[model samples]
Target: MASPDLIEQRQYAEAVLGGLNIRPFRVDLTDGLLFVPKSRIAVVRKLCKHFDWPFKVTALTSSS
Candidate 1:
């Protein structure tokens, strides 16, 4: 389960990023994980920090 603070952060992040035409995705159902593209990481990080949300960057790997 996600904390209330985290949920609010995600809602705000979605609105801001959506307004900028950058689509964010909830990549993990179990954790309610949200992510933007690598190209937008800096902007996302900035927003997260400004909003006082914990942010981490993780690389995605494909299983061939």
Candidate 2:
């Protein structure tokens, strides 16, 4: 279920995240990063796993 194309990846991500109520504060398409709420990290991780998407988590100095 790996997303081979960027457009499809974005669409899939949007749909999955929306359904899970994990709204991203920012989306950096150039780097393909979604800055979602810190509290929802676990959900995001689960979504990535379920979709066979490779993801990494990075803590940022921001409020959730």
Candidate 3:
């Protein structure tokens, strides 16, 4: 189960992404990390920058 704060964060993130017509990436709220699709990283980064959302992009070793 996710914590209340995490749930809230996820909802907010979803709303933000949805508003931009961009799919949301899985988030590790506890670690303050977001996993976005490689193909959409540029758009996601642009939106995050425009919205002043702090984030970092890192390559994943595996999709699963």
RMSD of each: 3.6, 4.6, 3.6
Instruction: Choose the strongest candidate by TM-score.
Output: 2
Please list the residue runs of candidate 3 whose C-alpha ends up more than 4 Å from where it truly belongs after superposition.
Answer: 1-10, 58-64
Q: Candidate 1 or 2, higher lDDT?
A: 2
- Reference-based lDDT, each prediction: 0.60, 0.63, 0.64
Which ten residues in a row are the worst by lDDT in model 3? Answer: 55-64
Which candidate would rank higher by TM-score, 2 or 3?
Answer: 2
Q: Each prediction's TM-score against the native? A: 0.60, 0.64, 0.58
lDDT of 2 by residue, 1-64 (tens): 3335765766778787787677654545566566677788777767767887544543333652
Clashing pairs in 3: none
Tens digit of per-residue lDDT, candidate 3, span 3-62: 786667567766887777665466666665667767777877776677555455433336
Ranking by TM-score: 2, 1, 3
Per-prediction count of colliding residue pairs? Answer: 0, 0, 0
Model 2 alpha-carbon drift over 4 Å, by segment? 1-4, 54-64
